[model samples]
Target: MSKLTGTTLAALAVTVLSALPAAAAPEHHGDDGLNWSACQGQVDPRQQCASVTVPLDYNDPDGQQITLAISRIPAAESGLRHGVLLTVPGGPGGSGLNLPSSAAKRLPPSVRDRFDLVGFDPRGAGRSTPVSCGLDHADLAMVNLRPWPAADGSIDGNIATERRIAETCARNGGPVLRSISSANEARDIDRIRQALGERRLSAWATSYGTYPGAVYATMFPRHTDRIVLDSNDDPDPSRVGRGWLAAFDQGAEDRFPDFAKWASAPDNPDRVADTPEQVRPLFLDLAARLDHSPLPWPGANPAELNGNVLRETMLESLYADARFPDLARLMLAGLGRRPLPAPVLPPEQALQNTTAVSVATLCNDVSWPSDPTGYAEDVAADRAAHPLTAGLPVNVMPCAFWPFKPAEPPVRVTDRGPANVLLAQNLRDPATPYRGALKLRAAFGDRARMVTFDSGGHDAYLANGNACGDAAVTDFLVTGRRPAEDVFCPAD
Candidate 1:
């Protein structure tokens, strides 16, 4: 059950407003307490912006406040409008401020016509009163951001990095940083719903967003109208982020073959091998070669092309099939067959904020074992079982040294919620694997039904262009209907 407090209610009531231009505030809408304004930058003209203030600490609601930036596109047909359909973004740090515009372009007209698409940058992200741990440039690299063990499988270096990161976050992240958690984010969502005067909210939540969406459903079942959890996460309250991280092992194993098939196609320009069977060994050999003889790559973080760098690139490329060529090209470069691509580094502040929010949420959401020995044992076992990920998934993260214990236990997603959720998943999602999606399905039990696509990739909505999965989800959102049981969408 949700552990709401009197202070939480007070925090929801505090109105710390956004500082948008005076010309942009919503005019002539007396019903909306929000002063909607034209969003800045090259955003869709239809997207209007606003902000809400929620307590920095729900337990001490009146003590401090933070703003949550929001955006929306009103229903095209107001006469037939049902209610607000919120879009919950992934990353735990990803901004949802532009979700309305994107969803407007993708969702079927029937669904779009019936509701206002709502989106928000969760507390401590994007324009929502952001926070940062102030990480150094060296630690901002993708290879370093993810905990990759040393070449010899010794976690000594990883331990030092985690400890340093944890110390940095503790020293720099203020109250809002410590307050970043799924539970608090859900509360912030509820505050948004209340501010909109909507009795209930329908949501299309993807990736890491699925966790808080499930938590919201569990916490306030009646407040949820309809929910679509896409690219689902395991709702295991016991392990939380640890389990999500560890799933990367199986996730990589599950998705690599798809990339291999694409890379090894006979006519493919980026072919790394003549046969799919040879692609795996070729990759392993290339990574091993890089590990032994690292190359000095200018402009790349750590300024080197090493085994972990290739592995990190591979992990990132597996997110979408369109990115397969990038990984294949990198493999060719590692084999002295091509040149290295230019790196794209995010601004220092953005990277810092993203890292802080992601790490803070993970560490604050649940407790991870502090002992390095346990992690070492798990890493060794995972490396043996799933060599593709090299036990990186089971490795220790900054969470191991996080200063604060969870404010409360991670919310247990139970079968207690209303039967309003429909989950859409890709069978071979590299980040949230099919098995993890099943676990989420099992946790929701009769409260939810799932549509699994026999496809490989991270996202499974309009992204994959799979008609079956998209149609099922659209039908559910357009009409309050779902398949009575779990269904499979065959590969197209």
Candidate 2:
């Protein structure tokens, strides 16, 4: 949430009202020109908020404008300052205005002394002049956001749901919604650099942010300093988000064993099975039972715990080992061994806003096939092959019914950039599996050095408790150096 006080809001209004004359691409400016203001809901009092105005559409720079909300925690030591180190978070919709606080606490003091930690809310998210499609509360549920086919693998319902979301967004979302894409995000980041009066920037980006971070590195190679991309997405220009979604099938398969092992452990209070092998069958049986008769979950967004809902919970719980209990407890409830847990959800407005941005960025990035027949066949085939995810990865989405074609081709990350790039990955990341991370590493060619941490769940670097992996990345960020070859850290 933005920490904008009334005075800060007025300052933002004044800043936007007195818009700077739209310039050429960000390269044209080296002037410091940010309007710093009051940012609310900040975890670190030292973090300050500011706004940077950029062209709403990069193509027509002189046309209209939009404000991007950014935050920064100044370098702790003035003499050692190297410049801005931008932090990019995941989600085409992930809010980054407070990311400086999140990143600062985890970084080493050596890094803290060298750069001002900077973060921003992308154009269509958080306080960056947010855009919303006013979607129905029911449509905002995770089970619905990613297409989860019917019990028999039919996509008839997916097609309709996707079409309705697309149509509603088209009618209600204005120019801003149509403008969200990775290419534009790259452009926005460049503008922020110019606004900060910095000649170059180092960046630490994770998950979806890595796409734009890579694009920024590719598009403005000379201006990028040190670059760190963690838990990366496959840079498939043609497929984009489609390929990312598909990875969930393989990712789920790779990460489930860890959960199974934990769930059957004698010390675990939430153990759901007597043995690791039995856990899979138990989960599949419980899900199938829920499909036949959904448990009445009173306060949940959808008001029921169906098979799809269980699958959605499983997908989220696989993100980190710490979240393993969420899935275990849900399994216990499904088996009537314990009561159902209360639904934990974000604020309705935040969900609505982020969902709108997510759909827009995805649909506007690339085209999706509109053929319902083809989607149904793919779903049926995927279900038979990967029952854990039940074809949710290959299923259709709102992009199938998107109202506009992509404004420009997706940015193709290449090997031509500087060798300052460092790629980090967890061996068993459920959202971004090793296979996909490899594709991204290969795309960067000799320009990057990869550090693979043999572990489960998503995120690497300061996230998982792998001191070896964290030291390698921290060493690189602090001294502008990387391992001579692709390094691997054996399981801890």
Candidate 3:
């Protein structure tokens, strides 16, 4: 399917229905009570945290168990409370522990009043007894973390790195790491619902969270209430993460114009070019020059302005409009127009855990073909077609060298689920582009309605998305209202 759609790149990468079907409802985990208490740190007065134990492998329900860290802020109006609205974070590895507090602030009063905002650090993340592959510091660098072939497109180094990382993960990432996957996440969510004693759950899922959310809806259709899948991702079960990595090629093309326009705007103090048209060429030329003659960047982690670092910066900066200046400043530094800013990196342990969980999820959720020659061919073709990404999108990741086959085939999303899902996506999301979101929308069929915003960036909800898109989602969550058909929110 990916080969045909030309969107598969490699492993680098809900509705209320109480009435419809009881058998499809979330599995009944016996009444295990949640003992919510004040969360650690300077949390909002209302924020509370609790932990739930779930099987390390659902297949062996009576086997070893792992704990999930959960947080919540009770609904503003208890009398009007509908149920739990889980805030599913991005990064198959992101911690959702703080999401409820932040999300509660963005949600409209009506929505906030009716739902207990909930968040959780998915198993193996954050406060949930984290696991790590204990990767080397150099290996943790962004350029190395994301597969970028040699300037000439030789993937020998990337292939080697993939093997080493995969082996390291297998050696160090215990059963907890092996347990991290989309299927398990959905199961964990069901456990959360059962613990919460809510037969149906409403969710606001973002980025990669959209995948598990969709999977949960597919696997347990009647278990969901009002579902809002934000910053949607492609739900193609076969390729899974591989297709997401491939979408980066088109995603970069779609999003770069926004950065270019911002960089060259007349009023912009850090203008990279006089006009938007010049910005693209200027960036390409700069990247090429750096590829050959790199610049010294002392404060930066790798301490150099190489082509891959610049490309990584571009990818990171495209996540939000406010981040455009970060890319511009880096570009300026590379051009010798300014000094490089100090790069702020997460703690080493944090990076290791995140990388481990992320790679594990992508690789474990589905299998990536282990053929290096096939990747070589794909990389060459992708390079010719989308030089901005320089074949990085289609390049191999640790998944290629993954030691284990998928425990189960990826979940195939279909229209058999409840028709309560509302998808809101940015037309030009760099991480998850419109084309991929369209695939997810199509998979949902009449079961879902997509509200696309004529915007550029990764997330499309309250952040990055305009008022139109925000209103559409807010309406769905607060009032169970969706447009008669899919709607497009014009750029603001």
How do the predictions measure up, each by TM-score?
A: 0.93, 0.93, 0.94
Model 1 over residues 212-263: C-alpha lDDT tens digits? Answer: 8888877767677888999988877888777888788888899999998999
**462 Cα displacement, candidate 1 (Å):** 1.1
Clashes of 1: 2
Query: Which of the predicted structures, 1 or 2, would earn the higher lDDT when compared with the native?
Result: 2
In candidate 1, which residue pairs clash? 24-37, 26-36
| lDDT tens readout by residue for model 3, 286-340 | 8888999998877666878899898888888888889899989989998989988
lDDT of 2 by residue, 206-240 (tens): 88888888888778776777889998888888788
Model 2: CA > 4 A from native: 1-31
Residue-level lDDT for 75 in candidate 3: 86
State the C-alpha lDDT per candidate. 0.82, 0.83, 0.82
TM-score of candidate 2 versus the correct structure, residues matched by position: 0.93
